[model samples]
Target: MATLPGRRLLQRCAAGARCRLLGTVAEASPPREGDTIYVKRPASAATRDETSVEMPMSFMTGSVVGKRFYRDATVRRADDGNGWTVMLDYRTLKSPAKRPLKLPSRTLAMAIAAEWEYQESDGIRPFTMPLMKLACTALERVPVTRTKVIDNLMKKFHQDLVFCRSPDDNELTIGVHQKQKEKFDPILDWVNTEFGFKPVVYTSFFGGKQDGELTQAVETVLKKTTDFELASIDAMAAAAHSLVIPLAIFRGKLRIEKAIELIRLEEDHQVILSHYLSLYSGSCFSGLTVQCLIPPGR
Candidate 1:
């Protein structure tokens, strides 16, 4: 079976082994002054057990600053074909990848253009372009790449959080287990009843394979959705690692807070354990320590 690198990291951490991450974010807290952290060398490298390397965390710490390049932004229905396209004065608007930006609806195009119109002449930020980004993906990427995207997204159905159970052997662990079942199971049940598809749940990470019929049922339901909708579903499912969560959210079956709660359960559990360890060992954790638990590949 193929391994999910992220899941492998979680598995190592669950075993309580001290881990040195390679080509990924480190799970351990930052090495203090005079402290050393080992890094796994690439397999092609000569070192069998590479040790003691410090990799600077290169991340965007500040907002992007770009001079606004357009004087005015506008939208018009495409005489070309199916829907609307945004334009910037004399220049036709394009995606960041320089692909022509075409959208499926006049309303969506207007909204995206409005975002451009609202931008200050001094600077423009990519963070402010949610509608544009979604539209760009739908138009520029989805039309050509939908099959591969759908295939990758459908694989996540196997490891959905709804199908995973927490360990139930101890009071602390059992509390988390109960919390998961109480919080996550009814949603699963609801989806089953609503969709006529019941996802298979697993007590252990390695123990489950969703049955062919259930998988086909889910695929059929997805196949009926629009390409744009599938793109959104693929994005949300990848971020939360749960097809059920995104589908539920799309269907308005879960509130935002409930969705966040489900998505952050693992991080919350790690936070609790960190607090416990800090209390017992008298070691303090910086804010970065907790933040590091968030997977960077996202």
Candidate 2:
């Protein structure tokens, strides 16, 4: 499927550097003096203009390492009017590589600014700012790691969750298989129709292989995707454990809620089985509670 129209606009804006920032202003509460946050530059930037790069440092780890130092989070149009950026008071927000966090969509910029605005004064938790992380992955990582990312995703595709069917013989399998047929079959059908190759389904816990032509076709689609789109697909694919689901979502054939339901279908059935077994067989499985199995918000 082609990239979504909105994503197309974003890609165009990002490439041309010719979009105007237009959206609600995002502003954070005032800040207090604290330790400065420092992120290391990616090694790849060494070949580029030195002046273009910002803070230079060594590698660091952890999501919540930094303390809040900026007074407020806000959005501003770039000096060149090329795109919008999230500003930490007078300091511009940069990616981990110290590259400008230029966003093609003002709506996205605002959302990212909100993430920063929501940070606690004691710590700047990078894990909480998903939009900002995504933008950084798109801008700093995707271009350099495109092949590796796609290759890893393709590795997951061979044993994708949707391609594995539960055996229909067992009582538990009966419900799981029915659900799979009802929910997953349609996705497989769409993949068949879209890629012109039927995906292989098997009962093996190890997973099954798809056709070579189908793999190549899916890879081609991924290869053609824009950096932002690929980054998004990568995130969704990792979450769903099935590339087909993300492709369906991108194609507008599946809603995110439906996709989540599908992803959790068999797992939910297992939870039901555990409950039944616990009550009837006088045996309990540790940590089999629904709340633990299925977290809030699906």
Candidate 3:
């Protein structure tokens, strides 16, 4: 059924056209805007049949801008023996207390534009996109020194940042942007396989798991309850210490393991915590100062 056309240029088309296979092509009529048309049956090279118009290549130009918005990302040294690090290189990372991060913003913008031009011809749209994020074992390149970068990141994407590191430079890069959201699984899998995130974090300014029995108690609470508490006494202080606790202020839709995985122990009576890591973590507690969940301290 060649609606709005006598016949289509394509002869071997499936339609209600009462035509037979021809060995020659036919000249057809030009098409108009906003017209409904279909290919005709058996086409030929020798027929000058007036039909539909040929479409211009410009009709398909291609792209989505970007996809997803993120604030922080985690990276680790492929061979530097460093645990985990976050690389911030966005205009937002230009903090007053930290060195301004350098991102390929201009370069990325150009890339996005080119990609969109190529993809727009198809039909898709996205927000922000994933790119390469890097991490350095040395403190010389921390995005911010005042607080844990993960803390701030959780506020933004509410999803854990995943990365793959370069063995030589410990830098991470995304092979492609605008990938399916499900693609994130492989990155998390890689992080777990490569980094092996154990539930322990240290109290040192760097933060990591310090091992022992309080670790056991922490594990038990997490296994049985949705959340827990942490009580500590500054073992180095003359008066008291602190501990680590798990807080879920805004972890609603976000996975538990993504952000604020652990908090310092607070008070001196008891402590509680849990692991979103499939509820799998061998807890350990050392001396640390814990304060109630408040923006002032974290």
Candidate 4:
């Protein structure tokens, strides 16, 4: 399974756990904010007490000030080698855990610095800074745990949501088939023509494995992606529960709206019904109308 970087790692506590940095369990008080700890878990009794714990990575541990802290946010070339780093007020920025924020690509570094530059005195919104998050994951997390994350995402690819279809039944059988062709077929055709790969589509949730050739082709593409790209793809794939959908969207073959439509294909009938009801029933009783007016993230 693909293991996410430390920043994405979860926090947990168990007795007798050892630390990653300090060899022995710190017989100290509970860990404070921004602290790293490893809770060891042995695989077998033969290797009992051999410490191996996943430590949680930190990000943005400092409190946000009302005003921007930096006079300027710019991209700077790395002093050690190739690659780039973001400079905040002439000083190099660091990750939440005090690690330097070095990126493999100049474009990636510039993108991150842009997020910092655009931040207002109001507050820091880390959630809005996806590029920065990806940079951190690439720098601190991916280098240590690349293999696990790749394997986990590969496993998820086979059971992608796009590969499964809603089964046809007596009443909705014809409608289901029609919807599949109308909505899903184009996406499949595009992949076949674009990638020279046609993924096997199933008519039921229990559908078996896809063609090995198609899976292999996908793996090949993913293997070539940078750590930043892979992290973003893994995230989008998990959210959509389908590697195909995210791949298409990322490559510009599909848009986010269309991908969302495909993900919710099983509810197409209900959506159409809701749309028509909203159109005919006027604004007062239409949930869809009310929802649209509410704006996003409400």
1-298: candidate 4 lDDT, tens digit per residue: 1122111211211232221110111132244554433333446635422323222343333333223444455565787877777765445666754566668876567567666655654444565577777767766677678777778877877777766666666554566566766887788888798678787887655656877787778888888887777887877887788888888987899888888888887676655655655555666674454432222233
lDDT for model 1? 0.63
lDDT (10s digit) by residue, model 2, range 1-298: 1224335335646686533222223333233233235433346655322222232222123245344555555566876898888776556677667678899877789778767666665556766768877888899889999999999999999889889888999875888998898988988999999999999999999997889999999999999998988999999999888898899998899998998899999888788767665565433455554333333344
Ranking by TM-score: 2, 4, 1, 3
- Which candidate gets the maximum lDDT versus the true structure? 2
C-alpha TM-score for every candidate? 0.62, 0.73, 0.15, 0.62
Summarize candidate 3's per-residue lDDT along 203-227 as a digit string, tens digits.
2332333333434443343333211
Cα lDDT, all candidates: 0.63, 0.73, 0.24, 0.62
RMSD of each: 19.6, 9.6, 25.6, 14.3
| Candidate achieving higher lDDT, 1 or 4 | 1
Please give the TM-score that candidate 2 achieves against the real structure: 0.73
Ranking 2 against 4 by lDDT, winner: 2
Candidate 1 vs candidate 2: the TM-score winner is 2
Model 2 local distance difference test score: 0.73
